[model samples]
Target: MTDSLGQQKPVNIKALLQACRSKEETFKALVTLSKTLPRLSAEKKTEENKVKGCESAVWLVVEESHGIRHFKADSDAKLMRGVLVAILSLVEGKMLADIQKMDLKAELAELNLSSYLTSSRTNGVLAILNKINTV
Candidate 1:
């Protein structure tokens, strides 16, 4: 669905965050979303644009128009792809400053994902933020 600004709106981040806070719900949602994402294929993969610090290979592409930022990402890992979807859904088309100000760590913590994420996956998340910041 589109928001008032006519940009695609995400599945509600607040609701997702809350669900993540509940162990059973978070696991269920993650599993469901992860299953839904298409797996990365050799033909679809790009080398140069791949995120550097992730344990699992991840590629993120960004586009901006009229002050709105859009992102497309793919990952070799299903769970990571789901995480990317969750993050992108929250920030896509949002103002840069607002995106920058977002307490992603806190939000993830609320979902109990903060502690479970690998250092590499955390870095991948930061890489996404850096990409958005640059746009």
Candidate 2:
């Protein structure tokens, strides 16, 4: 996908997953990606963008251009921010129908992240996906 800067690149998921020989490696890679994710300014992270069900304050805003959704998200916690970036990597810049067709749960499971999350965090992921669908 091309970013706002018009730089063409594939989503980092597959490569990062493949290169991670251990869970620790995967976590490190995800953290690095999270740090690079676009962040919302304090002004943009208003109540309107706040997502429920997350232990930390999480916010998301989506805009559509030419039928593709572009997501901007942030979280007060590092891990949640990483998870949000991973989720956005899959759904952003896709058509709503295509996003809906994706089995996000299974995809996340493949990353071996779900088993490591608390129930609340899992619910937060669901809430994020639901919010994306609504957009």
The number of the candidate with the highest lDDT is 2
> lDDT scores for all predictions?
0.66, 0.77
- The sequence of per-residue lDDT tens digits that candidate 1 reaches over residues 16-73 is 6465656566666666655544454565467666777777888876667787776667
Scored by TM-score, the top model is 2
- Over the stretch 1-135, how does candidate 2's per-residue lDDT look in tens digits? 446623223345655655677768878866876786767899989988999888889999988999988888999888787777777777778899898998888877766575447898888888998999886
Error of 2 at 63 (Å): 0.4
The residue ranges of model 2 lying beyond 4 angstroms of the native Cα positions read 5-11
Which pairs of residues clash in candidate 2, taking residues 3 or more apart in a chain or in different chains?
none
The per-candidate count of clashes, in order, stands at 0, 0
lDDT of 1: 0.66
lDDT of predicted model 2: 0.77
